[model samples]
Structures are given as C-alpha cells and as structure tokens.
Target: MSFNPKDALDAVRDIATNAVEKASDIVENAADIIRGDIKGGTSAIVANSIDIATHAVDRTKEVFTGEDDDED
Candidate 1:
C-alpha cells in the first residue's frame, strides 16, 4: 500500500464540494415550498403585524406624554 497525501486531499475536497451542493439544493427546495404556502397569507399577516406595532408605539407615546392625540 502506498500513502499519497495529494490523493487524500483531492478526495476530501470532492466530498466537501458534493456536500455543499446537496445542502444548497435542499435549502432552495424548502424555500420554494414555504413561498408557495405563504403566497396567500403573507400579505395579510404582514399588514396585521404592522397595525399591531403601530398601535403599540402610539400607546407608548401617549403613556409617556400623558396626552391623548385623539382629543385634538
């Protein structure tokens, strides 16, 4: 048996490259599925989240200033 460092290095590089490519494909496929699922609900979810956040900020401001903007 002959010990070849170059051959061993080449084999390791090949394995790493293959693993990365497979991982990338898996991630891309998962993203596609998620996009399909969220296609209809994503907009509504985002809108509701924005509204809630805005209301929270407004309430925080009123609490700090002790002034209600609605009375204006």
Candidate 2:
C-alpha cells in the first residue's frame, strides 16, 4: 500500500470544508448588518412622523384660538 493518494484526498477535503465554513460566516454577518440597518431606519421614520404630528396639532390650536388683540 502507498500513502500518497490517501493523503492527497484528505488534504483536498479539508480545504473544501474550510472554504464552506468561511462562506457561511460571511453570509450570516451580512444578514445581521442588513437587519440592523432596517430597524434603525424604521425608528427614525416613526420619530419624524411623531414630531410632525405634534407641530400640526399646535398649529391647529393656535388657529382656533385666534390672535386679535383689540377686542372690545
């Protein structure tokens, strides 16, 4: 029996396994980054909407109360 063919096959298998593992890790990291960005963007949009609504309400109240200072 010879030790050359078996050793070569084992080395090739090890290289393929390491490549697959590295690829998996990269994909997982990318997914996490995308998810975080989406969440942050949603929160910012909600906050801006709330601020606009509050300003609109204040303006509405002012319009209703009026500002004529010379009433008899």
Candidate 3:
C-alpha cells in the first residue's frame, strides 16, 4: 500500500482538533465550578460579616448606655 501524505495529514489534523475541543470543554467546566465556589464563599463571608457587625453595634450601644456597667 502506498502512503498518501494528504490522508495522513488529515487524520492528524482531525485528532488534534478533537483533543483541543475536549481540553477546552474541561477547562470551561472547571472555570464554572470555581466561579460557583467563589460566589458561595463570598455570600457566606458577607453574611458572617453582617452578623458580626450587628453584634458589635449592639455591644457598643450597651456600653455607651451604661447597660454594660451592671456587669462590671
């Protein structure tokens, strides 16, 4: 059998194209998962910060109004 250069090149090209496409899909999926995780983490941080701020404000108010003096 004679080797056809054009057919060999076409086969290589097809294989390379498929590999690149699969790699791109994997990268896209990974990026999506990372984005979701970051969003969830940010939301949790915001909620915790708000809770901490509220507690701080309540404590400050108590201190300023002499309510904390009773404990001392």
Candidate 4:
C-alpha cells in the first residue's frame, strides 16, 4: 500500500468535477422555479439555463485542464 500523489490528485479532481456538475444542475433547476413563478418569463428562463450550462462547461474544462480558459 504505497501513497501515490498522482492518484490522490486524480481522485480530488474527479470529486471536484462531479461537484461542479451537480451544482450546475441545482442552479438551473432553481432558476426554473424562480422564473416560472413570474408570468411571461419563458425567454428569460431559457436564457438563464443556457448561461448556467455554458458556465458549467467552462468550469468543468478548467477543473480537468487545471487552468482557466481565458481565450474567447
């Protein structure tokens, strides 16, 4: 039973990746509930969903790549 730093870091990265995905789901659902309460808010809700998804993808990429993608 040897301590492997690479394995530890990989495990941590996996956990972080899963967390980010779950958080994004929660935020998207919350936006639905919040926007649903208002009348004629379908467009706003859809836009919010897209925005959250884009951010989640970017964050997940950063987590796996271990760096931020600042390029447009």
RMSD each, Å: 23.2, 31.7, 29.4, 7.4
Measured by TM-score, the strongest candidate is 4
lDDT of 4 by residue, 1-72 (tens): 455567556656765666566567656666766866453345555665666567667665555565657864
Worst 10 residues of 2 by lDDT: 61-70
TM-score of 2: 0.40
For lDDT, the strongest prediction is 4
- Tens digits of lDDT, candidate 2, 1-72: 334555455545654565565556555555655778666555555554555555444443434454323353
Q: How would you encode candidate 1's per-residue C-alpha lDDT over 1-72 as one tens digit per residue?
A: 354566556545655565565556555555655878555445544554565555555554555555557889
lDDT of each: 0.55, 0.52, 0.55, 0.61
Candidate order (lDDT): 4, 1, 3, 2
Listed in order, each prediction's TM-score against the native is: 0.43, 0.40, 0.40, 0.44
TM-score of 3: 0.40
Residue 61 in model 1: shift from native, Å?
0.4
Q: Model 4: what TM-score?
A: 0.44
Question: What is candidate 3's CA lDDT for residue 32?
Answer: 55
Which residue pairs in candidate 1 collide?
none
